[model samples]
Target: MAASVEHDSLESMEAPQTAVEVEETKTFKDLGVTDVLCEACDQLGWTKPTKIQIEAIPLALQGRDIIGLAETGSGKTGAFALPILNALLETPQRLFALVLTPTRELAFQISEQFEALGSSIGVQCAVIVGGIDSMSQSLALAKKPHIVIATPGRLIDHLENTKGFNLRALKYLVMDEADRILNMDFETEVDKILKVIPRDRKTFLFSATMTKKVQKLQRAALKNPVKCAVSSKYQTVEKLQQYYLFIPSKFKDTYLVYILNELAGNSFMIFCSTCNNTQRTALLLRNLGFTAIPLHGQMSQSKRLGSLNKFKAKARSILLATDVASRGLDIPHVDVVVNFDIPTHSKDYIHRVGRTARAGRSGKAITFVTQYDVELFQRIEHLIGKKLPVFPTQDDEVMMLTERVTEAQRFARMELREHGEKKKRSREDVGDNDDTEGAIGVRNKVAGGKMKKRKGR
Candidate 1:
């Protein structure tokens, strides 16, 4: 925590007017955003710059290797996307811009953002993920898209197996959610992927957490990068109605459904800790009759893509996914975000909540808290240095379930202790219910006449 605070302090001191809070009298046109970009923004109903875009867009356009410390939904995608797209257009080369994400979902999301933003500029964006055809990816590569968004594993496979696909002329190497990609067990794959990219290319790394691993990767991959710390709270939007819950683990799932049903939000996302758990909860939600989508790494890439597309396109509202779904996911219409599983890392909480309260829309983050999750939330609050608001609700079923689970465990332990008190009446009694052979190295008389060695062996 101290190290993170020190880093933030240093970065804050270095940055002047970091975010665009006030209305800019000068248009994006004056800030170097092209006419096509403006037209596209207007078409998409994007009138003003997000705090992240305001700070990052200008810096990236200057051909700098920028290091952004931010979570998902901070508009970092457009921050880099708009500038890099324009930069590429200016050079007008048959080259590609590389974006590396932690998961296939994020890769697709960023690809969509690029295609949406740059399509008006006649810019091309292609996505490369596993479970999709390499032939298709190869064909897309043959088209020579200006930008390529891909997961590390799939990109490595393409580099190794697919012929005539190279990043030799790659201009931009953007690493989204660098903390997850650089911190998780995928470090070896990341090292391999980094080795494949040329040193001459520009690299941009974004993450919520700045662990030592992220620092090491920065030193190794990025060249004296310009670091900016856009804290999670800033990106989450102050307008967001933040709240917390305190209950036992047994009731969290039930309580979540209770509150969500009570609110009846238009759209929502539930961040899960694991894929299997996410699946179960999504199923439970459906049994209760809610429109839910399960997204995780274990799912087929096509399914993951389909689910994300549906969620983003507003086909079905509720989304269930892990941190794997958190990075660079563009869902502009999400009005609510539920923390079904508390984030083990503090930064994840910020990212999870950031999913909502985007595009200047008011939103809410309802965290289903349990005693098990309390510590995690405490750490998160400490990271942000504040407590969250607890939303008022009338749900006591959670308390009943918690009481039942607690009572069951208490009785089970008492039974085990009471069972030990009933002493053995004879030597035979001890062996009566024993799974193991009676006594070590003991002899037993088998029938009335024969003596046998006890098979403790």
Candidate 2:
């Protein structure tokens, strides 16, 4: 009887969470993938491949140039990785594969995936990134890895100075997040790096967003590529519990804290609009006796690395980060995602929430909505083509909301202190200017009055 009541309650929610999209599944062996790869997949507990993987892997193994457009977390990496490994397993010598990513995090991530896929067998992998010494990178390259995963700037740096990168022997090239790496203002660097590579190679491109800039770059990058589109823009995650809390603007943080304390998991991310907002939110969360950390662009490289390490280790339960810092970073065991600040880009919302509900797991995506965030939320909903349901908390959750009120008081005090300091500084500067101007004028007026009094006497 209670289950029926709860089911009705869930159903009444506007954009209720649905089940995952049904896609046809096939085993790796059934897809014509090698037994060695199939064995690894089974070992990893991957019984069957995703739709994108099922379609793209066979085409890739055929040595065909392909353009794969899929949603974030659609297992696109495996689509390319499996085929690359199969091709390289035949000829293990010489650097044969190059994958370009926009960020260093992704470079390391892809390199790790490549290593993992070939761990049963033997596959040599090298990663090119910045903020590290080139000597170490050169050393990694000197061993002549089978696959090289790299960011554009670091690749260019290595090409201009390092001698180990031999593109003539390269047989496969992939631009992961092709729009971010291959086009935009940053694309000039990617274009220059592309010119350094041999054109007679099998090219693979993948990204969440496919703009005209990417299409033009694709023409120049590939030799008549095959296009595959899997997910459309703003596609909703069916297994995710999607809802919003319609609270007053001032009480948003309170309501958010209420939900966070009630949720039954550790290791989650809160999306913020900017680095400052992310930092401020982290500090607020920390003040509430919860383990929270901030991630954003303003943070130093070492700090960002440290934050992610801590997050992965479960040292921090909640990570308050902006979208820019969170991109291309895949963290395991993220239980829930909170949209503290609505994403400026609708696509970013997809990436932010994709952190959870990954690898056949059920997760919840909760958003705190205010008047300020309504339009932005609408944009997100419109893009995803779903109206989310409104969900209110239970009785035990009320205490957490009280704690958030306390936190808001602290935030107000902090803001007031900053405002007071700014006003104090401005008042002091104005006082000094007034004193300087009065000095000469006061003396002249005094002298003239004194002279007039003496003459009258």
Candidate 3:
């Protein structure tokens, strides 16, 4: 079952001049949402409106541009989806909305939520992201889906090359995770998109924090926007039990294995710092008989989605990922989040922990802090304005797993070397056939011939 949006007690961070206070108990209908969307919301098990939804939907329905600031899991999707679908109900058109996201997985997730919310209305969404065949994405764009969810780079690729495709008639523009988009340095691509789209469209900018870049974007894109902020400070939810494990750097993996065995039945999202580390950690865990999957930027788009779906379905007990999965993804049953690698940026720590303990559910987050990471970890604690208590562990039990863990690590390293060699050979075989300049045919050469038909949106 889908998790319902609950009322959060956090106050708005920085209310803009046009901001309006939303009552806690207001339903979707009370926020001036239409009946059809309300029914769709009910079907999705969103019985009560989240705080952002309650505050933003009414103004959005009134055709006001908005800047929504909230934590990752505070129902930001519902806040934007309802208003866009409702407007689609009134003004039926192809390419009605364009949602720009930072990552490919997030693009697909947003498309799923849009389709689920507007399923009765037959809302079609085309996801355009990198790491897949561009021809297929071009075809999806040619179909003229009701909403186009895309990353900046891939969308620009299509806009320049995909004939008969344009967003001149687009009515709504949503920049989900606006801060992350800027952080990833999509400013030029975003500018090009801004110039290409219609000037009189309704724009919504949603971000966890209002950074300087986001503010500049608001000035350039939005007109007299209303600010709807759900959280006034950087803080994790109360339901999340945050803790840290201080261990020697060499024994980090052993401590991770020990903790996983200690809390054996719970699902885990273990965050690594790099793609290679994520892959290696996943391989090591799998070799030790754990159902662990890796999701990182290096994998193909299909494989990434497969990993996410497998974890979501409980087919896998562990999800090993980089910061790519740290923001704006709503996976409801994540029982724990392990920071195997502490995030360098203090702000990212908040987003990483926000993945679990969502929607009124209790969860745990354990950060692995080594001697080298003390300064970074301290910065995180200071930023969050609270010191996390140490998570209890038995040193003898942790050391007991060291022998098996060392063996698994050796195996993982071997597998990684072989995988890297295979990729090198594949790329070398492709040689001149690779479209380096246009990004048209840069798919995984190993699976290039087995192009599967993508599921319909």
Candidate 4:
């Protein structure tokens, strides 16, 4: 009964009748954003503001604390960034704003967007996250970049340890993906951060959903924030074609290979349930001569960024990842999202499929459901409020590749075992403390070449 009541309350929050309606075609200049930032927006190809931006920007410029509830792929970044940049232009202060994200990849992605939008104005943003070196990050913080983007735990470490580094005068605080942050159980760190930052600052909390924890944090962090909600209900866009395939558990790899062959010219972001599975799938796909890369929690930060940059640059066509990539890392050219393993939680299904069909581009999401996954699959359908159509498959052709897939799977398993052993040996050789929480190795640098002179801007 309590769950049902909570569900109803969620429904009400999602489809609120009293929410402010924003004009879809509103421009940034009309939203009271300065002409210089408007030029930055134009350079980034944002001719008009998104719905969330339209609603939040004007109020944000008016100095209102904001709680923006919008779905994945919505322009939540811009809704917070433009206003922050606009404010930075006025004040021109270092360590002006702090943007907190859930994951390292999301932190990097947000930093990229902030840099791209603030480039013309010479905005420097530092990213602080785990699996990266503290010394380098300390150097970055020493420089006192105008903006600091960080994950909670790592940021807390710095706050406590890094000398002469504090956000005492921070003008703005943004909790991007606030729901995920709480879900990851970073409440203690967030509480610590809240205690340290000045109380006279503007706070913007943006989340895909309004949960009890987010509400609690909002009350604690914000002072009468304006609610900007673009999507009150959980639903995929019309352009996303979602489908499911019921197959035997053992033949999952074969089906994936068959699908990749069938959908040849398109890039794919395949979701797996475990880090081992992600690595195995990438190895399997690569063994078959496909340019597949893996990203998961266990990987070092540099490799993770390398994989993401490779995918973003189209150097790799297929990316196999765990839920780390699901929430906020936006890759523009993902043509298909293959759920190689159906998510256990129904809500995760929404985020996994959200990778594609973003920013008005049509895309496909296919989920593999085994006999044991019927109940879970049913739960996802119930959550989405619709029955998914069956994705067409050639079973005979899929069976034809089973032998090759089995051999590849064996190779993948062996590789995983060897990799695990190597990790175990390394841990034994160099005590665990050597890999400090946020310690990062040298990044793989891009090759430098002579610059071709360009015409004046």
Expressed as tens digits, the lDDT of each residue in 60-122 for candidate 4 is 998988899987778999999999999999999999999998898889889989999999999
lDDT of 3 by residue, 18-134 (tens): 243444445788888888888888998899887888778877898878899988878888888899999999989999999999988788889999999999999999998877688
What's the C-alpha lDDT at position 197 in model 4? 98
lDDT computed for candidate 2: 0.72
How well is each residue in 279-309 modelled by candidate 2, as lDDT tens digits? 6566566556677777765554455677888
What digit string (tens of lDDT, one per residue) describes model 1 on residues 1-457?
A: 6545644664676545553333552456656788988888777667777666666666677776778877666678887788888877788765468898876667777887888888766777778876566788888887787888887777787788878878888778888888777654567877887777778877888877788988988898887567766664433577788888876776776577776667785688888887656766665565456777777665556566778888878888888887777756676787888888888877777777878877568898888778777677888878777788888877665454445344534543443333224322233454421111111311111111210121122
Models 1 onward score TM values of: 0.77, 0.78, 0.90, 0.89
Which stretches of candidate 1 lie above 4 Å from their native place? Answer: 1-16, 19-25, 232-236, 395-457
Worst lDDT 10-window in candidate 2: 434-443
Worst 10 residues of 4 by lDDT: 446-455
Candidate 3 similarity to native, TM-score: 0.90
RMSD of each: 14.6, 16.1, 6.8, 7.2
> If the candidates were sorted by their TM-score against the true structure, best first, what order would they fall in?
3, 4, 2, 1
lDDT of each: 0.70, 0.72, 0.84, 0.85
Which pairs of residues collide in candidate 4? 14-232, 132-440, 133-440
lDDT of 4: 0.85
Model 3: lDDT to the true structure? 0.84
